[model samples]
Target: MKHSEEKEMIRDMARRVAEEQVRPLIASMEESDRFPEELVEIYGDLGLLQMWVPEEYGGPGGDLTSVCLAKEEIGKVSLAASTLCANNSIGLILPLLEFGSEAQKRRYLTESAKGRIVTSVAITEPESGSDVASLRTMARRDGDSYVINGQKSWITFAKQSAYMLVFARTAEGKGYEGISTFIVDCKTPGLKIGKAEHKMGRHGAPSYQVSFEDMRVDADCLLGPEGSGFKSCMRILDLNRPTVGASSLGLAQGAMDQAMRYASDRKQFGKPIAAFQAIQFKIADMAMKIGSARALLYDVAAELDSGDMSRLTLLSSMAKCYCTDVAMEVAIEAVQVHGSYGYSTEYPVERFMRDAKLNQILEGTNEIHRLIIARELFGRR
Candidate 1:
C-alpha cells in the first residue's frame, strides 16, 4: 500500500478537490438525480479526466495507478465523482490510447483533455449485460459508411457525450470476433439518447438508454481492426475492474472513518459507544477488511502498471469482487453504529450504504465476476 512521493501528491490533490469541490454538489445531485456536468471540466483541468493519455496528445501522461489513486480519494467524498473519473478515463481514454489510430488519438485525446468532447462507451443492450456476444446492435457496412441500428441500455453519460464508442455486431460469427466498435458522434442524425436511470445512489453520473436508428459513421471511424472491438474491450476491462475496486475501497474507508468518529463521540448508557466491546469489534472488523482490500487493489494496480497481463484478469476480478463486498459490509456496519441517525440522511452513512450497493452491481455483478474468476482458475490449469 506504499506509494511514491509523486503518487502521494496525486492522492492528496484528489482528496482536496473532493472535499472542497465535489462535496458541495452531492446534495443537489442526490436530490434530483442531476447529471454531473460540472465535474467533467474540473476533472479535465486537474488532468484526472484522461490521466493515462500520453503527453504528445496534450495530456498529462499519467498512468492507471495514478488514476486509481485519484478515484479512491475522490470516491471517499462522492461515488458519482469517482465514477465519472473512472468512466471517462477507463472507458474512453484508455481505449483511445491503446487502440485508436494516430490521427484519431490526436484529435480525440486533444479534445478530451480539453474537456470539449465528452465521451461515453455504449456496450450493454437490454438483452446483453454480461454477455457481450449476445449484443443485438447491428452496424452494417455501406459504400463509405456504416449504418448502425439497435438500442443500448445503461450507457453512462451518453446524453452528455459529444462522441460515443458504440459496439455493435458487424458480421456473422459465433464468438466475440464478430463485434466492432465505431466512434460515432452523438449529433449523428439517427442517434437518440433517452432519459437517465434513477438509481439508488451515484445519481450524478447518469446512465441512459440510447437508440441508433440507422446512425451512420464514416468508414474511418471504426476503431482498431474490423471485428476486434470486443477482444480489445476484454483487455481494457482487465484494467478497469480493478479501478472500480479502488473506488469501492475508498467508500469502505470513508464509512469506517465516519463510524469511528461517531462511536468516539456518541454516548450510550452514560458512556461513549467506543467504550462498548461490541462497537469496538465492529470498527475493528471494518478496518481489517478495508486494509486488506486496499492492499489487494493497490497491488493489482501496480502489477497492471508494470504492463503484465498474465495475472490481470484473475486479480482484477478478485479486486473488484472483494473490495465491493467489503464496501457493502462496512457501509452497513457504519450504519448500524449510527443507530437511528444512520437511517436518516443526517449522517452520510445512509448515502454511503446506498452508494456501496451499486459498486457490487456495476462493472459486472459480483456473481458474474465469481464465474469469471472460477473460469480463469480452471482454464489456466
Candidate 2:
C-alpha cells in the first residue's frame, strides 16, 4: 500500500524524536519509575496526541496509518513512552471522537489534543481482566447524575491523568449489554487512588488501582448511549490494537538493532561474534519476524483507513497476538546475543523484555485473542 507524503513526514519526525529525545532518558525513567511529563508536553506541541482528531477540534486530522507510524517510532526507543502516547491517542481520544457529544468533544478533545490534559481509560479490574463483561463496577442513576462505585485495577496513567473514561455496570442484565461508560474527572469527590503496582516491565508507565465510592458525574458525562459501553470499548480496542502491534514491532526492531550492534562489537575467540553462524541466524530470524509482523500491522491499519471494518476484530487480535509474541521472542534472542550483559540492568534488553510481555496480556490476553480468531474462522458468534 502506498502512503501519502504527510504520513512519511510524520513517521520521520517521530523517529527522530524517539531516537534523540526519548531513547536517551529511558534508563533513568525506568530506574525511578518516573512518567516523562516533559516528553509528553513536547509530543503534545508536535500534535502527536491529536493526530487522529479532526482538524476543527485542534488536531491535524491524520489517519490511523500516521498514528501507527508514530507509535512504532516511539516504541522502538521506549515502549513505556509509546504506550503513554498511544493511550492518549487511541484509548482516550478515539473513543471521544467515536462517541463524544459535540460539547464533550469541544471540552475534552481540544485540551487533550493540545496536551494540556492527560486522559486514560479505566476498564480492567482486579477480578475482571479479559472477561470485561464480568466487571462489577456500578454506576447508578440518581437525579441527573450517576453515582459510580467500584474499584478499577491496572489502570494505565491513573497517577497522572486529569480525567479517566470509566466503564461500569448500569443495568441488571447479563453479558455486555449491562455495561456503561462515563467520563469522570480524576479529582472528583470520593475518588481514591491505591498504591501503584510494581510491574515486571514498562515501569516508566505506572499503573494504579482507583476506587470510586459514590463518585458522581452529570448525565452529560455519558459516552454514547446507555448499555453501549462494552461495544464502544471493544471498538476502541479494535482501533488501538494495530498501534499495539506497531509498538511490539518497534521493540522487536530495537532488539534486533541492538543485537546486531553487540554482535559486531563483542569479540569472542579472537573474532567479532557477528561472524559466527549462530549469531547470524538469530539476526536473520529477528529481521524476518519483525518484517512479517510489520506487514500484518500495516495491513490492518490500511484496512481501517479504507473504512473496511469487516473482520477488524479478527485482524486486530491476530496482529496484537502475533506481533507481541514475536517481540517477546526477539527480546529473548537479543538478550541471548548480549550474553551476561543482557541480564544486567546496564542493558536495555531486560527492560524491553518486560515491556514486550505486557502487550500480549493487555488489549485482551493472547488466549482471548485466539478465541476471537477461531470464532471468526468458524463463523461463530
Candidate 3:
C-alpha cells in the first residue's frame, strides 16, 4: 500500500501545521470551551480546511485519502482541530458537492473551500438520535419559500457556521422518504443557536443545540431532490465515516507514542520499564491493533479514492467501528503504562484517553455502526 508523493506531502504538511498552529491553540480552546476562530483562517490559508474541494473550485482537488492522511496527522495533536477539519471537508461539504446545483455550488462551495463560510449539519434530534427517519423536524412549503420548525441537538460548530445543512420533513410522514435537505443561512430570522453542550473531551470542539422556529429559506435552497434527504444523510455519513477512522487511528497512535516514551523513561524494579516483559507485551499489542486498524482504514480510503462504492457502507462502518475501538483500548493501555501519572493533566495520555471516548460516539455511535455493518452484510444488494 504505497502512497503517492502528493498524499504523503499532504500528511506531512498537516503534521507541521498541527505542531505549529494547533498546539498553540489547544490550551486557549480548552480554557474557553470553544473552537479557536483564528484557525478557520489559518487552515483556510493552507487549503487544509476542506481538502475535498476540487481544482475547478479553486482548491487543490485533494482526494479522500489526502483528507484522511491530513486528519491522521492533526488528530494526533487535537481531535478538536481534526473534528473541525473533517466537518468543513467531509461532513457538510460532501453532501453539497454531491447534490447541490451548479448555482448553489458557485455561491457556497467556493467560499466554503476557502474556509470563509463554515457550514454545520443539523440531522440528529433529541428523540431520534441515530434514527434519521424518525426525526420530527418539519418544513412546510409556502409561496416560494420553505418554513422550518425543529430542534437539533449535538450539532458541532453550528454557532460559528455561516450556513447549515438542515434536514426536515417536507411531506406528511415519519419515514425516511419524507425528509429533505436544505442549506439555510445561520442569520435567518427564526434560527436560534443554543448553548454548547458540556462534554467529557474535546472541550474546544463544542456541540450546540440549534432550534428553528418557522425559519424560512428560498425554494432554491433545496439541495438535491425534495424528499431525498435521508438518502443524502446516509451518503454523507458514508463519505465521512472513514475520516473518523483515520482520526481514531491518530488517537491510537498518539496514545501509543506517549506510552512508548513513558515506558522507555520510567524506571521499574531496577531498570527502564521498556525492558519489562509486561511493558513489551503491552506495546506489542498496541502496535498490532494500531497497524491492523490503519491497514483497514487505508484500504477503505483508497477504494473511495478510486470511486468504488460497491463495498463502501460495509468497509466504512468497519473502519470507523474498529479504529475507534482500537483508540479506546490503546489510550487506556497508555494510561495504565503510565500508572498514576497517566490520569493526571500533566501527561497527554489522559487527554488522549478522554478524546478517544468521544470518537466512539461521534458521526455514528459504535452501536449504530455495528448495526450498519450487520445490515450491509445481511442485506447486501
Candidate 4:
C-alpha cells in the first residue's frame, strides 16, 4: 500500500476503536475526573504508544505526519486520550532518539516500544512555565552521578509513567545554555508525587506536581551533553507543534460532525435547522476553517519530517496558533448551532467547547505562538 493508503488505514482503525471502546467510557471518565488507564493501555496495544519509535526498536518507525493523523482521530473522541498518545512522540521521545546513548535507547525506548512502560517529561516548573531560561531546578554533579533537586508542575502522566525526562540547571549561567536533560526513573528515591490537579477539560487525563529532593542518578542518565538541553527541548517543541495543531483540528472536525447531525435532526417551523441560511453559513465556515487549518498542519508536519529547520519554526507557530484558534471558534459555533441543547451535557458540543479552550493555552499559548511568529517575521529588530 502507498503511504497515504496506510495512513488512512490507521486512521480508520483509530476511529473504530474510539467508537467501539472509547465512546462508552467518555461520560464516566468526564464525570469522575480520572485518567483512563484502560484506554491508554488500548493505545499501547494498538502500537500507537510507540508510533514514532524506529523499527530497529520494534516500533512502526512512523513520521510526524502519521503521528498527527493518529492524534487527529483519537482527539476527535477524547482530547485526554489524544494528549496521552502524543506524549510518546514529543518532548521525551525525540531527544532520546537523537541524543541518547545506545544503552539508554535500548533500556528506555525498547521497553516503551514494546508497550511495557509509559513515559513523560518534566520541564514546566511553577515559576518557569514558558520562560525556560529561568528554571530553578538544580542538578549538581556528584562524582559519577547527579543529585537533582526541584519541583515541576502541570506534568501530565507523571503518576502513570515509569520514567520521566527531567531538565535541570547543571551550571550557573544566565539563560538556556546552562541546562541539561536527564532520564530519571519515576521509582527513584527522594522523588515525590504530588496531588493530581482537577483541570477544566481533558478530565480523563490528570496533571500533577512532581518534586525531586536529592534525587540521584548515574551519569549515564544524562540524555545529552551538559548545558545543551534547552536546545533539545526547543527542537522537540518544533517537531511536536504541528501535532498539537492536528489535535485541535480534530476537535474542530468532531464538533462539526456533532453540529451537522444536530442541525439535521432538529426541526423548527416544519423544517430542519439545516435548511436555514444562518445554520448553513455556520456549517460552511466551520468546514472552511477545518480545511485551511489541516492544510497548514500537514504542510508543517512534512517540513518537520524533512528536517528543514529553516522555515519550520515560523510555519509551526502559524499552524499551532491558527489551528487552535479555529478549534475554539468552531467549537463555540457548534454550541451555538445546538442552542440550549448544546449547553446541556446531552450534547457533545459543550464538552468540545471546553476541550477546545485548552488547546489554545497548552503547548505554548496561542498568544506566545503569535509572538514567536511575529518575531520570526520581523527578526529581533
Q: After superposition, how far is residue 231 of candidate 1 from its true place, in Å?
A: 0.4
Candidates in order have lDDT scores of: 0.87, 0.87, 0.87, 0.86
Please provide TM-scores, in order, for all candidate models, with all chains considered together. Answer: 0.97, 0.97, 0.97, 0.96
**Candidate 1 structure quality by residue, lDDT tens digits, 193-293:** 98788788877888899999988889998989889988877877777888888888889989999999999999989999999999999999999999999
Please state every model's RMSD to the true fold in angstroms.
Answer: 1.3, 1.5, 1.3, 1.9
lDDT of 3 by residue, 1-381 (tens): 479888888888899988999988887877778778888887888778867877787776878888888888999988888877746755456877898888988777677777665678899899988778889989999999999999999988899888888999999854999999998888999999998899888878888999999898999989998899989888888888899888889889989998999999999788999999999999999999999999999999888889888998899899999999999999999999999999898888888898899889978899999998999988975
Query: For model 1, where is the 10-residue window of minimal lDDT?
Result: 85-94
Q: Assess the local accuracy of residue 104 in candidate 4 as a C-alpha lDDT between 0 and 100.
A: 82
The global Cα lDDT (0 to 1) of model 4 is 0.86
**Cα lDDT tens digits for candidate 2, 1-381:** 367888889989999889888988787788878888887777877877667777897777878788889888898889988887645765568888888888989988787767656777899999998889999999999989999999999988887888898999999766799999898888899888888999889878888999999999999989999999999999999888888888888899888988999899999999999999999999999999998998888888888889988888889898899999999999999999999999988888888888899998988989999998999889955
> In model 4, which regions exceed 4 Å deviation?
1-3
* Alpha carbon deviation, residue 153, candidate 2 (Å): 0.5
